[model samples]
Target: LSAGFDVADRCHLAPVGAAFLATTSSGVAAFDRNPGSSDATIVTSSMLPAYRGILLPLVYGPGTRSQRSATPPRLTHGPNETFIKAAGARSLAVLLDVLTRAGHVV
Candidate 1:
């Protein structure tokens, strides 16, 4: 993430994007705040689809603090990026999904 993506400034992120990230990060942090809690107790279906199902195995929740996986999806702007030409809401939605997976706790 860029330095501008820092939640404090509200710089690079769209409003919804920032909110989603902030919320997700808080959830992760909450999990970290309590380590002895069983993983199953914290891994809830409310997680985004990217964080759900068998692939959930790929992520190891922090015991006492909120932490995200190493490689959450990213939304990049490039000539080949299809969503670039789409409507603003569409692109924003895609970007929000990426940020959500990245564990932004809005």
Candidate 2:
């Protein structure tokens, strides 16, 4: 809904205060590249129970081209944002599909 969070840096995002939202891979890919090795995905299962069932974990398959990590990292600070990252093309495609199914993309 928002173009981008009003933060000093691209890394800074809005506080998650109970909002229904999902993100695409292209966005997280750029962030991962910018930070040069950061957790591509951050989930707060404890805080948001809905997230547990709603989110589809982005797994790095054989063709995934983005940076890979042993375990996806979680957000350290405030703001309940989820970052799902993987191969830009496939990940983004999945995001589009999810958004389409969610009736966000017309």
Candidate 3:
């Protein structure tokens, strides 16, 4: 149960050949601000060699405040619920793909 920031930091120190799947809502709202513009939430890090890192941005409802607020709102319900499930499914798929590429059967 690591925070997004923590996971991001640790990614730098992860062993070679390590695989990671992490989700975070941070910066998502800002990135999705433009109307009629949508980008894939799933991203892979290319800077980290020998590491397979997947980052899934969890979308929040419109008008949601920044996570840096003094009292950040909980995101376990409402429209976020859907995003959470989607992130989980994507994460699982990415994990399976990583394992398969490593010569492991799922």
Candidate 4:
């Protein structure tokens, strides 16, 4: 927990009401059917708002995922950071598929 966030801590914000799919800890999510948020899947603090999801495929591809060749490069984690996860080609492909199906017509 290098970020010092408790595992059980919830975000101070909630997902947008009409966000058919919201990026979440486990991946994009669909909230519960009922409105009370009782069985809803919530997003983590790192999630961008659903309104920004149209930017996902453009942002998640290739070097951007790990910032491997970032300009003025920086490591996302500290020396003690245990997890180093990123969306590789296949994962990006899957996300692209999801975005395509989301139908953001220009």
Candidate 5:
């Protein structure tokens, strides 16, 4: 169950095995299927030349079930223009990379 950050946030009803590609203030995040714990893990920011982004593992907790009804703070509100632009650029770069790998000229 892959989706954008917004869609992923609303996916509180998603199955336990589902994973999502979510964007964060610093970089990108992915839902991790850690059955033993509910806490999400944050991997150190990668300094590798091929990839340079924070790896945040978003895990579903008891609160996730009620997220649909709760008024969660949105990341799209005021004063997030810079982060939005950076996230967009990173998304585009990933898309282009995937396309290029598939033999499509970009």
Candidate 6:
């Protein structure tokens, strides 16, 4: 598991192509499958901070079914601003393919 984030505003941005595992009226638990051979999980949980919002990262081991410290957020309405919703796991194959064929991140 990893650290937790608290949403502090309505203009927060969510990374695209990330998968969501849980959601509630106050927060959300989003994650992206590791793009590596180890297959570790990269999870981000955002909660409604009393007034603003925040984002944090949490990492989990590979092949685990249940998440321990990596819990979901309590989100009510859909993300107020930009949000990331990934459909598939990110693997080394995908990263290498993109890096080799698509050009570097600028």
lDDT of each: 0.36, 0.35, 0.34, 0.33, 0.34, 0.30
What is the lDDT for 86 in model 4?
47
- Name the Cα RMSD for model 1: 17.9
lDDT of 1 by residue, 16-75 (tens): 434344555645321122224334434543466554332211122221122232244223
RMSD each, Å: 17.9, 15.0, 12.9, 12.5, 16.1, 15.1
Arranged by TM-score, best first: 3, 5, 2, 4, 1, 6
What TM-score does prediction 3 earn?
Answer: 0.28
User: Ten residues in a row with the worst lDDT in model 4?
Assistant: 32-41
**TM-score result, candidate 2:** 0.27
Better of 2 and 5 by TM-score: 5
Itemize residue pairs with steric clashes in candidate 4. none
In the range 21-78, model 6's lDDT, one tens digit per residue, is: 2221223333434444221112332234432233423243332233223336322233
Q: How does each model score on TM-score?
A: 0.20, 0.27, 0.28, 0.25, 0.28, 0.18
What is the lDDT, from 0 to 100, of the residue 15 in candidate 5?
28
Cα displacement (angstroms), candidate 5, residue 43, comes to 33
**lDDT tens digits, residue span 13-88, model 2:** 3222111123434343222212322232343223366654333333332224322342453332324323445344
Candidate 6 C-alpha error for residue 46, in Å: 15
Candidate achieving the largest TM-score: 3
Q: In order, how many clashes per candidate?
A: 17, 1, 0, 0, 0, 22
lDDT of 5 by residue, 25-80 (tens): 23444443343322232222223423322232333332223223334532322342
C-alpha RMSD (angstroms) for model 2: 15.0
Q: List the residue pairs that clash in candidate 2.
A: 16-80
lDDT of 4 at 78: 38
Rank by lDDT (best first): 1, 2, 5, 3, 4, 6
lDDT of 3 by residue, 1-106 (tens): 1222124444324331133322123321122232322222223222343333443333333333222223444343334322345545655565565446445654
